[model samples]
Target: MELAKRIQPTMTRQEQEQRDRKAASNRQLTALLGKIAIYVVTTTLAIIFIAPWAWMVSASFQPIGDIFDWPPSWIPENFTLNNYTRFFEEANIGRLVLNSTLVAGSVVIAQLFLNSLAAYTFAKRRFPGRNLLFVIMLGALMIPGQVNLIPAYLILQHVPLAGGNDILGNGGHGWLDSYAGLIVPSLSSIYGIFLLRQYMKSIPDDLIDAAKIDGAGHFRIYWQIVLPLCGPALAAMSIFTFTYHWNDFFWPLILITSESLRTLQLGLALFVVRNRTVWDIVMAGSVIATLPILVIFLLFQRYFIRGISLTGMRG
Candidate 1:
């Protein structure tokens, strides 16, 4: 009887251990299945988003006829460089690229400087009505940009002492059809200021105080200390600013008239011949127009992601 008792207890212990092992294995399997599901969903989403761009790139290489083939070939049937060569030959691509580069670069630099300065003041300096001002600025974001277009046009068009305007701002196309028109209005972006402000708020106040103790002026501290630390945020703002201004069609269409002043987006519109659309030329131009932004984004992607995340964490 004692022998049987001992044997029964041993068997029970073995069964319990087996059950524990089975439970662990089941948990591991469930976790693995969940991971696979997540990967599958993400991969599907990536493909869906990337397919259009892939088609665009593929079509850019194919002949116009192949681009419109019944089945819509993803791969080029007759690969040719005619589209690109024709685009470069027909369009003053060099001038368009220069104009766009000039405008976008100017806007990025100005916004970085002006917005960061305003952001630093709003973030660190204590003054009355600061919060109210910031609220007003944020509120401006809610207002559609189109709503301000007319007002901006009127203001720029009649600016006193600009573009041959008299004291009353009523003369020779104040800022119309000029680089000034394109670059000036975009000098300070409210969204850029807000982004930089949020990021700057995360910086320790103690650093600013230390700089002051050493007799560093506000400008010195802002330039030497705060600006360096805000590199990621600035990088993000630059990319956004550059991309927006570079691709902006409506504003330039309204503001610019001279062929010399036409931006890349405006130049692309030229591809739309009177009634018919030149799909091949459009594709080629799009590929060209997209390259700079793509390069810029790829280079600053790390900073852009980090800036967006950290800026939101504190504010």
Candidate 2:
């Protein structure tokens, strides 16, 4: 009887140990399955988004005859440079690229300076109606840009002593068909101000105070200290501003009528319309148009990500 009692206790301990091992194995299995599921979902999403661009790139190289073949080959059977060569041959690519670069660059630089300045004031300065004004500005974002489009155009059209307009703000085309018209309306963005304001709020007030103590004026402090510290945010804004203006179509189409001042997007649209039947060449143009955006993103990606991550941390 004594031996049986001792044996029973030993059996119970062994059974408990077995149960614990089984439970641990089950947990590990469940965790592995969860990881696999997450990977599968992520990979599927990546492929879905990347497939269209991959196909477009492939189609850009395929011969014109092979572009619409059955089964939709991802790899071209007949690779040719004819489409790209023909694209340059038929379009004023250099002029279009130059116009796009100029417009986008101007907008990016102007937005960075103007928006950051406004953002600094909103963030660091104390003034009456500051919050109210900020809220009003943010409210503008909720309003559809289309709602303000006509008003903006009219304002630009009637500027006194500019673009052949009289003091009464009516006489000629005003800003219509001019670079000033294309650029001025986009010089400052409410969204940009909001973004930079949020980011700037993360900056310590001690720095600004110290700069003032050292006899630095607001602009001097902003130009020397604040601007350098806001590199990440500035990079983010530059990428955003450049991309938007570079790919802009509707605004430019409505604002510009002169062929000489036409942007890349405008030229691309005309190219598409003119070569509706030649899809391969169209794809080549698209590829070229997309390159600048890719380059800009690649150059600023690290800063952009850091800026976005830190933007709302304090505010």
Candidate 3:
């Protein structure tokens, strides 16, 4: 009886400890399940978002006939560089790439400089109608881009003595069919200015004041004090600007009539005109067009993430 009683008490204590550990484990699992679910869901959505582009890349390696196989195959059974071969063979891919690079690069560089300057002015400098002007610019973002297209096209079309026009901008194509048209309209961006301005407001006033006390002029203060501090914002804006103009179809299409001047996206569209069923080459060109931007994104992703977070918080 004494042995039985001692053994029973020891067993009960062990069982109690086991129960407590299980309860604690269950609670942890329940909390962890919520986080795990979120991770799973977000990861799934990321994959879904990437699937089409992934498929496009995969199909680019496959033959034209195999693109629409019974089951969509990411890995091609018979891989060939024919699509890339045909891309170069059919289109002036080299010239198109050069044009796109020139256009996108110019836009990115110019927009960063001009917009940063304007944003700094808006954020730091005292000026008349500053707030009103900013509001107007914000409103511009709301307006459909197409709303101003006709007027912009008319201006380029009618500019004097440019393409072949007389003194009245009526002799020839003004900026139309030229690099000026492609770059000029895209250089100024209201959205970029706003993004930078919002991000700049987060910077403390003492920094600028300290610079001012150090005998820095407005421009110098801006260049030295503000620009370096806003690197993340600038990087993010550059990415957006580069990507937007790189993939721009409608504006470049309207401006560039020459195949030599056609951007990569425009040249790729020509493939659709030539053959709807020939998606392999189209996808090949797409992948080519996508690579630089993708690489750029990967490189600047950290800056982009920080910029976006800060801009969102302040704006």
TM-score, cand. 1 vs. native: 0.88
For residues 41-102, could you state the per-residue lDDT of candidate 1 as single tens digits? 99999999999998878888888888888889998889988889888887789989999999
Write down the lDDT that model 2 would get. 0.87
How many residue pairs clash in each candidate at the backbone level? 0, 0, 7
Best by lDDT: 3
- What are the per-residue Cα lDDT tens digits for candidate 3 across 160-201? 788898998886888999988999887879888988998898
Model 1, residue 32: displacement in angstroms? Answer: 3.3
What is candidate 1's CA lDDT for residue 208?
Answer: 99
CA RMSD of all predictions: 4.1, 4.1, 4.7
Which ranges in model 2 have alpha carbons more than 4 Å from their true place?
1-18, 160-171, 307-315
lDDT of 2 at 264: 87
With a 3 Å backbone cut-off (N, CA, C), the pairs that clash in candidate 3 are: 159-169, 160-169, 164-171, 164-172, 165-171, 165-172, 166-171
What are the TM-scores, per candidate, against the unseen true structure?
0.88, 0.89, 0.88
Single out the weakest 10-residue window by summed lDDT for candidate 2.
306-315
